[model samples]
Target: MAEESTKSWADTDSESSSSSSSSSDSEQEEVHYLIDDQTSDDEVFDFSNIEFTREDLVQALNDMVHEYKTLSHTFEEIKAENASLKNSSAKSSSDELEDTDSLKIELSKLRIENELLRSESSELKAEVEKLTK
Candidate 1:
């Protein structure tokens, strides 16, 4: 009789564990479906049915805060890099403008010298014609 009782108890324990595992599997499926569903912006999330311990909630909040801090640091780094690129671009533009202005001045000076040389050549040509005549 004792042996029979032991066997019965063993069977019950196995059955209970199997049932609990099936229920846990079903709960996970429900959670996955809920996460996959897309809702409109006006819809609010309902968390009343889900169960969580206080420690779980606290851990989740801490994780979110850590993520926010990491993202904030990354954003600041990007802003600094953008500012540096802008400053470099502005300096390069200023240098190009200065070079262009210098080139224009040199061209104007060359044009004035060319006119003076042409006038001198014409005077020399007239003197040569008078002497030959």
Candidate 2:
């Protein structure tokens, strides 16, 4: 009879442990489900609080317009400046081309003069040699 009681007590202990584990699992699942529900509700509630008033919208739009105008003015100024720089650069390039042409003409004239001087020097040398002979 004592052995039977001991066996009964052991069976009761195993049953309780298993039941407790199952209960704990179910409690964890419930907690997770509640957390998910709360998170969804909180997100919805947060969105509801983000209302934009008409005045705020108007101010934002006006600010954007002002910024756009300023940017447009800046862009136009840059374009004008760019055009001026291009004109100046073109004029400078034209001047440089003219200078190059003038230098070329001067160099040609100098070469011709150098050749004439060389020819004269050769002729003078020949005449001197003949007189000496």
Best by TM-score: 2
Q: What is the RMSD, in Å, between candidate 2 and the native fold over all Cα? A: 23.5
Give the alpha carbon lDDT tens digit for every residue of 7-69 in model 2.
666796687677777787887688667656675644422222347443444555567779999
Report lDDT (Cα) of residue 96, candidate 2.
Answer: 100
lDDT of candidate 1 at residue 3, scale 0 to 100: 50
Candidate 2 wrong stretches, greater than 4 Å: 1-51
Distance from true location, Cα of 97 in model 1, Å = 1.7
lDDT of 1 by residue, 1-133 (tens): 3455556667966876777777878877897687657464633433334665444445555677799999999999999999999999999999999999999999999999999999999999999999999
> Stretches of candidate 1 above 4 Å error?
1-46
Global lDDT scores for all candidate models: 0.76, 0.76
